[model samples]
Target: KREGDKWILNGQKKWIGNATFADILIIWARNEADNEVKGFIVKKDNPGFAVEKMKDKMALRIVQNGIITLTNCEVEEADRLQNANSFKDTAKVLQMTRAGVAWQAVGCARGAYENALDYTRTRKQFGKPIASFQLIQNHLVEMLSNLTAMQTLCFRLSQLQDQGLLKDEHASLAKVFCSLRTRDVVSKAREVMGGNGILLEYNVARFVADAEAIYSYEGTKEINTLIVGRAITGFSAFV
Candidate 1:
């Protein structure tokens, strides 16, 4: 809605990160006239803007998520991102951020795998270190393999991004593959840690929860898979 020379925003945004303390917020809203999405930077002290912190998150607790509400929040046209015109612009941002999510998956998987590996070396079962057992060794090797593959894939994805050769499908493929593999790796980590796996003191349990969050963040596994599938077959599988 327009008020004199400024636009008034009314809506709510969920899962906003660092919202309470953010000096500036990049708010995206749909334009009523054309139904095109537009981006605006709202100052922290805007009276019409309010934020409520989201609580009881299982992972990424250090980052504060919030629910932002705007009731007739006035914004100057100058605060708008001039280049951002439509949902495609918003998608450009998501595509870039999705690559970071893929990297996050790899890091989570690697950390869990490493921590579990160390625990196995010191953890004894039946009077022998669990790492010496054939079954436990298999889990370790599998986790390491998945972790290694994700690392190499992310490295190449970064290179493609740096070279301006990265496409939406490329990032989507990486996001789906890495996040799915990370889930497997974290599960194996918890499995190898046995009874201690669920304990927060053991460290693997935190990764287990965080891995689950990563798996569904940016885009769910099914969503990203459809994106890659569409690119490969020229068929839009998203319904």
Candidate 2:
């Protein structure tokens, strides 16, 4: 709602990371009058803004996620993001960040692979190092293949970004592929570690859990797939 030069925001947000301590927030809301999505910069101390931390998280527990409530949150016109007039403008930011999330998937998989490889080499069974076993080597190879493929693909993604040719579909496709591969790679990493894999002391456990978060954030596999599907087919499936 608009009151002269101010906007009154009322809403609730969930699964908001870092909101508990964030000094400022970039809020996206739809203009009731124009029905166009707009962005606002709200300070943490705003009278109508409140945040409550969420607990019992399964993944990405290190980061504080919060629930935000806005009750007649008053924001000045000067605080509105002049560049963000519509969802399309907001999408420009997501497209770039989605590419970065693809990179994050790669890193997560790499960490798990490296840790698994080290454990296999040191862990012994049947009077020999497990790394010497054929099955273990096969799992390692599969993980390596996925990791390499994801890395090379993202390398091209970065190049496209640098050339200013990055598109939403490109980022979505990369995010889908990399995040899926990361899940596989991390699972294999945990498998090779045996029972120790689930133990936080091994670190692969954390990677396994964190991969789940990565798989869903920045867009889910299904949503990103639709973005790519629409791009290739010239059909927008989004309703």
Candidate 3:
């Protein structure tokens, strides 16, 4: 929205997954009068809005994403999300999604480890299966260690969530920790596969690329760390 209590939305949102087919989308916009963030439910048939499908994504290719444009989009005051008064309420949604992202990381890492392990069992080096080698075994063990730790931590995180004690800082911490460790595990999994590591047919390569998206999305490590830092230090580091 612009000035003078008039609504005039003109912007584009990229990588908006499912926007092309979504019946209703919650669009976040700044109020013209107060410049405050507000949300409106935009229906699929809205004339002023258009969504273009984003194509040729290397990672997370199965997830259909779209670039949305809102041109002179109009919504009544009653259509605005009343509860989303500020960025704080928006954070509540992110906190919940962050926890889910942590679980997704675990799944991604576990899939890579399993695939790499299966490959190692049949891949031979020095006249012996690669899985029998001390170096390969060490790598597998390290991957398992990190994966186990992430699983346990996320289990505890879900407990906090179930108990209604989950906070933004807590979710951010899990998101940061799991995503970072998942990156390490997936990279090692790819490394152990030798030249086949980079091949999408081997499967570990996809996990490696997907990990990059998971690490940056929801919240980057720096942002999540600052969230936890502010919780403990009582100082807002976010500018």
Candidate 4:
């Protein structure tokens, strides 16, 4: 709501990463008058902005996620994001972030693969290291294959983004594929770790849990799939 020279904002955003200590926050709200979503820059010192730190997340524990409440948050007209006039502008940011998430997934899977490989190489069984076993080698190869595929997809996605040809569907497809595949890669990493897989000392255990969080965030597998589906099929799967 607009009030003289300032806009009043009231709403809540939850599971927001970096909201707890962010110096500045970029918020998107629908202007009741125009019915178009607009962006606002809210400083952390604003009296109307309050945040509570979320606790005990299974993954992404390093990030401080918060729930933010804006109680009649007041913003100067000049604080509005000049380049972002509507929701479509907000979506452009998501497209880039989704691509970045795809790359993150690849990195996560690669770490799991490397850690699992090193563990197997020194983990002795039946008078030889487990890596000498045919089945263990097979698992290692499969993990590498999935990791390679994720890398290739994200590489092209980055190229498209650099070329300014990136589209929402392109980023969505990469996110959907890489996040889903990372889950598989991490699972295999744990599998090769034997009973030690679940142990925190092995490092693969964290990746296993982290994969679940990555699978859901930025967009879920089903939602990203629908984004690509709608683009190629010329229909809205969203109701």
- Candidate order (TM-score): 2, 4, 1, 3
- TM-score of each model, paired residue for residue: 0.97, 0.98, 0.94, 0.97
Better of 2 and 4 by lDDT: 2
User: Which prediction has the highest TM-score against the true structure?
Assistant: 2
Whichever of 1 and 3 has more lDDT, that candidate is 1
* Best first by lDDT, ranked: 2, 4, 1, 3
Best by lDDT: 2
**Tens digits of per-residue lDDT for model 2 on 100-154?**
9999999999999999999999999989999999999999999999999999999
The segments of candidate 4 whose C-alpha lies over 4 angstroms from its true place after superposition are: none
RMSD of each: 1.1, 0.9, 1.9, 1.0
Question: Model 4 over residues 1-239: C-alpha lDDT tens digits?
Answer: 89998999999998899899999999999999988889999999887999999999988888899999999999999999888878899889889889989998998999999999999999999889999999999999999999999999999998998899999999999999999999999999999999999998999989988888888888888989999999999999998
**Of models 3 and 4, which has the larger lDDT?**
4
Runs of candidate 1 with Cα error greater than 4 angstroms are none
lDDT of 4 at 174: 98
- Poorest stretch of ten by lDDT in candidate 3: 1-10
TM-score, cand. 2 vs. native: 0.98
Tens digit of lDDT per residue, candidate 1, span 1-239? 55666888999999888997899999999888888899999998886999999999999888899999999999998888889989889988888989999999999999999999999999998998999999999999999999999999999999999999999888999999999999999999999998899999989899999988888878788888888999999999866
Please estimate how well model 4 matches the true structure, expressed as its whole-model Cα lDDT.
0.93
Give all candidates' CA lDDT scores: 0.91, 0.95, 0.89, 0.93
Model 2 Cα RMSD, 1 decimal: 0.9
lDDT of 2: 0.95
